[model samples]
Target: MLIGAGYFFELLCTGQLKPVAGQPIFQETRFGWVVSGPADNVINSGGWAASAVNLSITENTETDLEQSITTFWKLEEYESKSVYTKEEKECESHFDNNINRDESGRFRVRLPFKKNDYKRDTQLKQDYIKCMSEYEALEHMERVDNEIENKDREGKYYIPHHAVRNDSSTTTKLRVVFDALIAEDRRDFQHVLWRPEPTQPIHVYRLNTLTYGTVPASYLATACLENLANTECDSCPEVGELIIRDFYMDDYLGGAMSKAGAIQLRDDLISIMSKAGLELRKWLSNDPELIVNVHSDNNNIRGRGQCPDSQAKILSEIATIFDPLGLFGPVIIIAKIIMQKLWQIKVNWDDVLPDNICAEWQRYRDGLPSLNNLRIPRKIISNKIVVITEIHGFVDASEKAYGACLYLRTTGVHKNIDVKLICAKSNVAPLKIVSLPRLELCAALLLSRLRNKLIPKLNLKINRRRFWTDSKVVLAWITSPSGRWKTFVAHRVCEIQELAACSEWSHVPTHDNAADV
Candidate 1:
């Protein structure tokens, strides 16, 4: 059976269609009510239906006569039979619900929608937005990248206008040179280069400007590139590669795995830079033969020697080389504690230290000379396949501090399981009083995060992971449901589980925990 356009549209929009005396266009569906005729397309249109009766109002001020009509529709959820209502009062209420007198007066409307529909439509709009965002993703084209780009890579490489004084002999005559870009103060200070001095009345000589002082960063980089460009390195590519990243400003600092490579790089550097009028004179090396070749004038010019006695005095003055591996974290932590103690007493910039502080500082300083004795192996060759490799993390907290440390253990690679301190981190406890258990939990979570990060870079295939903590309370908390704990414990437990789900949690005697150190 076919329905008229008006009836069909009403069926689509309102979930109701009454054919002239005999036909029905509405049908039952799993989703309340929907249109039955024409095609397979259907909607849960019952959710969109207005109130019971349809209200039509028409106003004609020209005659002062207004007419309104009310009509009924069947509902599938509650109505099995058609119901009819013709109440003028229902029209008045619907009109009042939607009306707020405006310049465009509501003259006439065959109540298109009942009052309640507008409220639900507005509320559901946000949910529809979410639904479209999720379900419509595959149907639509991916969003275009509209962000404006700056040529940052090009900008990073730009040299400063002027750098490095050509005449400065603490340095040498550069094989390459650059023009000096004058400073703001010297903008009007330019006298023509190759010209006579200002004091001299004679301008007849070819004008020349005198240049002096430190060179800018830009000129230095360009000069370095130019020098390398001129130097021949086709036969010694390894030395050339070392020189590329090794130079810091004008000084070279680099390392090699083999003494032979070190000797070769040193000799090549001396020969190559000499072409640019630069001398590689002060060479120091661990290998005796390499040192003998350069024959450094200073007797103490030995690599990996003890710290100078004077360098041992000032904590801040001596270079604290950035140790990413945390080999000397315990030693560094001592210095950090001393610094914090100094701050606690409100020590001024130039304050003389208390005798106890100075004595302790001196003792720590004396121990630093011995730290040079520690060395990381260049390589650990193992033929046997790794049977098991495990990372063990230990966490601890005190009134003053909290920390976490990791160790890597490997078996089958060695007769006795080889173990090494992988990395460690520590934090001073906050001034606010906190329960020891909470701090212990914080340390565990920190170690879990460290495990997540270091796992990707580890060369050995890890078979197991473990976390150690002395705090029984924290252990109880982790083994228990998250809801059993308070806010502090619950949040940290959730994070720890997320990051270290594969890790086993275990108790460790406080004396045995390396993190306690």
Candidate 2:
């Protein structure tokens, strides 16, 4: 009976069945009653057995996903290791042998496939037929003559393909994916699609261009772009450099100092990319006039949406701001402080914010509209030649945050002095309690880093750079030797010293420090 019970007695292992004190318990099953309780040691006294199992599952959070994506793309941006496999070498050789320019100067490339024969899947053939019918209707593929014999298919290989449909895709809602591993049998059969008709024989078709989802599609496309840039470098060096440095995949991101410079750069980019059969569209710029001629429909520009009423919505709104230079650091810091507070209290993203924070956020959101009235010169100074240029940086720290701002001071040929704010950056104070003097030092270090980064990028010939802070303790730390301070202070002071000389840093009255805002 026990043998036939099978898993009926498994509950005893689960510990859910409790024995009555000195009483036997019976459970009814298809095999009959089973008794279990505290019993005299009959077999246990002679032997002992033990078993254990452990399991763990970890999920990728949003932060982890973002970090992984950053790391993956960073590898692509840098040169690969100084090593190559046989397959890699072959791929490079094939690209060089088949890549060429057409009569219109557009680049043409071929697929890279290993020399191997692969078996075909029946389901793949059915999918290919269904997809090719749509492709022929759209005029994306043409049918070949049926007179071609099987002997003529020597260099041709059939590719297994299937259609993928995504309702959320803004562009092509449906696209066909070709499997590279199964499609590697023939070099000439890049994509062998077929369509059957009741009254006629099955027709064969092939995709002309490089198909997405292929193993070497991304490599081939990137190589083609690099080749275009290299070939055109002699005639358009600047544009070629921009294409190499500024392009992330198909998008081009760059800037110029003046309207004329921007226009010239735009024309050069269009001319060069057009040579490779690439036309840039949907151009966007901070200056409306720059894109007015290209995008005549002003409605295409995104307009402000309804005000955010929840924490999640507010965060989404904040992410939409496009201030890369941190020119609005002072105004933006308020929002950052609110966000930090929300995180501190461990507020749910979609939950209603606390009354105090919600009120503060609402006030900040309401005042944002007034920013339209604020204006600053795009260029630091007029086109007139300047004899002297200097960068002045200010830093300050409060109990809640620290910030740094830079100003460009120029002396024209007429001895006229012009001062303008160049850029600014700010950060919320760490949640860990810290001394005000330490915060002040952090601010000073922030200013040092900002100056060091801006100087290399600025086109002007800066004669001197100076930093200002309101904290006397910070000035003392900068003047004294870094070895005298603790690890935190010592590290920041050392970096600050390395970035700027002790003499370049000075003290300013609290009221006079612009960063105090």
Candidate 3:
């Protein structure tokens, strides 16, 4: 029986179990290998007896018996080893004290949730809190409506009678609700107006000029719009878009006012407020904690019916409502994209260093008078001043190449105090540096540098120090009245004008200027 059982086990292992109902075994080696009934064989006690076993060639000949043995053994006695994670353990520990609690010594199932577990419930609880807040605000609004209705019932329509209205309690409550909502959104009213860029970190709030102040209210609204969905006030559009829309609507209603006009009005209002010694705009722009003027237009006939200034102020306030951190990610990202696109366009090298002056420089350096014999020596010129320009075509595009500028000055109109302007390029190009044109600029920078660096060393006390450039355009720009040169080259012209503020700037019409050497 053991032999037969072993034989049967071998057949199962090799997967060769096949039998004809009444057939005898064909044994080649005369070893006992016979099929038996369940009644006779102890191994077949679990109903392996007399069963029709079928066998067919199912797989390829190169199957691994060792791997099959390992798989069968693993299936028979192996138990899956489960690893409990830290979260699972923590959950189990939490469940031990809360979920699986013993009540009256009986395993009482906890129904669902406790009062303190409102946060655990995702839907109903959050909705309930939001609804409650809205209801409170609505109730406050309704109370204001009720007070107005009572006033109407009393027939108080006259100016004096209407003047004695009292809705402070309701108004205060409404403000509280709005403030709470603002807080929830991580937007603080005061913060929006004062936040700076995260990377540059320049404090915009501190830069207050007579013309403009630290972050405008519209800027704050821009921040809110940028962080709309992520903020507590997700439902509301940014204050700027709404304000602009409202402004357009007002324009539709026979009111023709532009942002520029509003700005002008603000200035006028500031002037008016200053007369009363209550310069609110300046203070508001400068001091973060300064209380804005709420009652400035209360009695003034000029501040009649719809106070535009007050509306603007209010809108500005709303716009600056910022999240605690200042500007959001999306706004910065959009701003960066804009900046990148701007960077893509080729740089204006001519603007950096113009070619006309550069051509003149080449002429000046080639034994010309402009570089050496100007009304003032190059050495005494301010190092900040431009002396000569170098114009060279770029390898990629000749029309839009570099225009290297050089500034030179003498220390005190002395020969030793000479300064030179060198190429602004990374590597020094000798030919470009010492070339006829470049030398003139180099001479200018050298002179300017020398004047600045060596004048103190020389201890020269000249009452009227001057520097000269032969460009008539530059000279005109420097000497022209601010009102006359307002177009075409205002920025550049202003720069030249500023240079003339300290030193005597006069035209040296190409012939006498030594830089033209």
Candidate 4:
């Protein structure tokens, strides 16, 4: 019997019915036709009728073979849902046990196999679709919707499942799920699954972009492109803001303005300043003279360099001195501070900071006391002026490896230690733009270079040239007792110790340290 609504069984063979003397017998298709032995045949032929035991496959031959297979076996027909549920358990068990059985309870019957078996392929595809549909329904049971929560912590928040899936970080998770599906599908063989392409951000062009207040769009564009590969989207906008701000503040306005270039980059800087919203008032300008301290050559500790700690101290002192009105002091005494302590890690400017770059610095000043007293001696201040040597690269051909510079100053004034670029004899070795620790060693080596070439060159020098940079970590590392800097910095430290026999160096904060500009 056909078990359920969408199914039918093909009758390949049939049983026969016996005829009686007075009654005509007919075969029935509903219940399988049954045959009985006749009494006369039972006596003559050992109780078996010839026609009763013999059965034949009924066929309309060529035409009926295809029609019968299609109609009764449902090679291409819609299966009712109820019939699917009825057959599901049996089919599932057969698949699970790697056994195949016909719906009529027949076993071990082999059908002719063909390469393009469309009926079996279609059934297999439908089975997977059913499984996936059921799987999604189960997974969605706990949460039908996603939610996101914004916490007050810095750089941190919670994202719901929907948000998580949308983020780039979740690409791996998607890949894992896809891999699992592929693995399940091709369980008998090893196979690789293809993944979707990753999405990338669009870069938009901005006009009126300022480079040192001069609108050097070309230079700014080049710098932006140089660091483009390192750029990631996490804080892309914030980094962009810094690029814009630094171009204006550092290249045009900072003490290192002349180092930027010709074309008088910011020829009308004052007008540019007007656009930036800084009004130059007469009373604001008249209050105090700007003092700039240049610590060009000491390697032991930062003596005159405006280290962050010292710079903070100086700003506080001025705030104390000028902060009477509470409002005016914050505006007046505090110098514009730009710190680049980590700039070395990000940029190795050995290419831009050329070899044999002309430099002049103030020699070490004597009669200076340690910073513990918080007083800068007058003699040291008055006598401070040293001729700076040309800074060169670590190699003759490569220009990227260049020496470090440190500068400090008060608000609103340019100090007499103003620098100008000029061609000079190539005397110093090129500096190496290695790691931070190595860079510190390079700075120390540069100081030692000054002592070797300058101390005897200056009759044992007045006292000692002060070295300054923004790396407090480097400073502490080099100055620590029994400091174990890497061999490069250690070697440089030894040179510094010998140079200390003549002069001293100091570490400074990046804010008050202007050389980074």
**Highest lDDT against the true fold, candidate:** 2
Better of 1 and 4 by lDDT: 1
Candidate 1 ranges beyond 4 A from true positions = 1-315, 318-321, 376-385, 413-416, 481-483
Please give the ranking of all candidate structures by TM-score, highest first, separated by commas: 2, 1, 4, 3
lDDT (tens digit, per residue) of candidate 4 on 1-517: 2255443244323544445663334444343543334334334447544443322346435443334323322212212225455344543443334423335322221111113322556754454455455667888334424333533458743332211122365332221123212111111232334435446444443322222323223433333322331232233444333334444322321221122321122223333333333332221111022211211222222344422232223222222222111122112211211112212223232223212111101111111223224322211112234443222111011122223322221121223443321111111122334555455455545545533443342222232245554566556655654248666666666666765532244655556553332
Q: How does model 4 fare in lDDT?
A: 0.33
TM-score quality measure for candidate 2: 0.62
What is the C-alpha lDDT profile of model 3 across 186-223, one tens digit per residue? 12222323435666644434222111132223333322
The superposed Cα distance between candidate 2 and the true structure at residue 283, in angstroms, equals 1.7
Residue 39, model 3, lDDT:
33
Candidate with maximal TM-score: 2
- Candidate 4 residue runs with Cα over 4 Å from true position: 1-401, 405-433, 459-464, 481-483, 501-503
**Alpha carbon deviation, residue 242, candidate 4 (Å):** 52
RMSD of each: 33.6, 15.3, 35.5, 36.1
Off by over 4 Å in 3: 1-135, 139-417, 420-470, 490-495, 506-517
lDDT score, residue 322, model 1?
A: 42
lDDT of 2 at 415: 89
TM-score of each: 0.42, 0.62, 0.19, 0.20
* Residue 224 shift from truth in candidate 1, angstroms: 17
**lDDT by residue for model 2 over 195-275, one digit each (tens)?**
676777777676677777777888887788788888976876877877776777677778777998888888888888888
